[model samples]
Target: MPTPGFPPSTLDSEGTPIWISDLAGGDPNHVLHVVRGIEAEDALEALGAKPGLIRSCELPDSKPDEWTSLPCAALGVEPGGSAALLAGRVGEWTFVYDDSGFTYDDAVTKALSADGRTAATSVYTINGDASLTYAVDGEQVEWVNFDDLELDEGFAGMPAELRAAFEAAGNVETEDFEPGEADGDILMRAACALAGLALTLDDVRRVPLLVVPFG
Candidate 1:
């Protein structure tokens, strides 16, 4: 059965599953959008992808790393473009696996939420740093880095329910804590929990997907 607020296989009132942050689990870099009320093409445009470059394809296996090297031709990747992005819909929202794109661009997050859609973005860079953001209707509500764990807005615009639930499952801060795998796990759960997403492993692995240029 589904947890009260979180997805069936996601977090609970107690905590997140141990599997959320592993290489065998969620994509390392992603921006999950609550696009239920919008169309797929519109959602892509909102993320600032080039309109004519979108391609259709299917994932061959369940590897999370495949997102980085989706068939070049099948993904419609241009000769001189930034990294390619893969997108797939899971229920009402669209899950986008981004590679070296706009995960940190405040503008992209603003545009995505401008149309009343919510966005949850998270990333753990190889340099031992991590970032997470939650936006609603063009307003950035949550912005924090694993290095500091200091929320820029202090849960200002989050709904009462999400705020409390996130506070519970999200990790607590330590004085000299540098981010590690555990921090990455927190990001995976936050990307979904903060945006009210309910993603399961089966939803992304080997799913039919849309590929677009990062720019």
Candidate 2:
């Protein structure tokens, strides 16, 4: 059975599991808007981004998708296998992509290319081992062990009561905690609570996938 606080998963017509983010509602400070169809340059232009302000980086070969013919020059630290490209920053939002792999569909890409205003809300992915890899802005943060996360000083910003609850939840010493299961559910709640994030069970399952945070 699905956890109480988590959202439910849906299956696409092809029987592929589709998981939505638990953080999709209300107005969020951080969001993942997949700009489809638009080439790297076109997407930036549509966003009103100035030519001189754009930035790019060369990611390591191990990374998912590294685009060799990126429209902009390489800037910032080498993203290694974490991210292939950080196109540029537009106002409060940043544009990013992995030339190594495709994250969006053809229709979404077409819409984004045709009109700069079109974008799809994105959700991060969870790995098979229940580890979460995500990015803030364009920087990558990964290998987060949801079950055994240390709720020490890093979580000082959380409420006292919430912190205490997470501490009381104890840590999972097991190698992995399967998402959607009871153990995974507990860890997911604790992690979200510490990060001051609200997510559903279905959202938790989509971990090790793709997630965009909102402050």
Candidate 3:
């Protein structure tokens, strides 16, 4: 059996995979906090979600019109519903949760735009092993395991000065640095600075990199 907060491979009676969140032990009351922005909050409230009564099963379904209110109708409970809501929004970035399989690394794997072009350089761990994944248009483009590579290798494309700052911050080291040790927020800011893009740390953390072409 999968532990709490982990995505489950077991299919519901309808054959849909189950995804869950750790917020409030998958309780709706606590997990709803993951939803941000007054717009998103209003949508949730209009959908009949209330504090302390929201359950993992009562979230709106992921429909084709995900960004619109169509998906906000608290129609029925579905497996992974809570996770879907939690990953719904954090301002402009739309979080994408991995529901393809059951794994302890069940987390927001991609944070992209509504148009599906830009994406965050995602860092996550599985069973204590850390890795980095770069994606575009919802497709993974690169994946690197921390153990097989140095921390600096991932940021080689970054500008020299920004890279140096990261190194000075102890985020990039040839021999001693390990993956999952560096602060993701700091690294994201460094990347943004190198690109000359003005963005908040929350934006950096949500979607670290912007995909070139809108996809």
After best superposition, candidate 1 residue 133: deviation in angstroms?
1.8
Tens digit of lDDT per residue, candidate 3, span 1-215? 11121122322222111222211121121111111122333333322335344333223333333222211233233434432333344444333222211221212223221134434332333233434444444454444454564454645764454345344323322233345444322332222222232333233334321110000
In candidate 1 the C-alpha lDDT for residue 110 amounts to 69
Model 2: per-residue Cα lDDT over 1-215, one tens digit each: 22232222332221112211121111211212333233455554443445555444332222122322121112322222322223432332333332222233333334343433323222223331232223223333222454554444443544453344345433332345343222433333333323323333243333322111101
Which residue pairs show collisions in model 1? none
Which parts of model 3 have CA positions greater than 4 angstroms off? Answer: 1-85, 96-116, 121-126, 152-154, 158-215
Task: Flag regions of model 2 displaced more than 4 Å.
Answer: 1-33, 46-48, 55-74, 77-95, 98-118, 123-215
Show the colliding residue pairs in model 3. Answer: 57-77, 120-208
- lDDT of all the models against the reference? 0.53, 0.32, 0.30
lDDT: worst 10-residue window of model 3: 23-32
Displacement of residue 109 (Cα, Å) in model 2 is: 12
Best by lDDT: 1
Candidate order (TM-score):
1, 3, 2
Per-candidate RMSD, Å: 6.1, 15.0, 15.0
Candidate achieving the largest TM-score:
1
User: For model 2, what is the alpha-carbon lDDT of residue 185?
Assistant: 32
Whole-model lDDT, candidate 2?
A: 0.32
User: Per-residue lDDT tens digits of candidate 1, residues 16-97?
Assistant: 4322321122243333344335555666767777888877766434332443343333454432256556666656666665
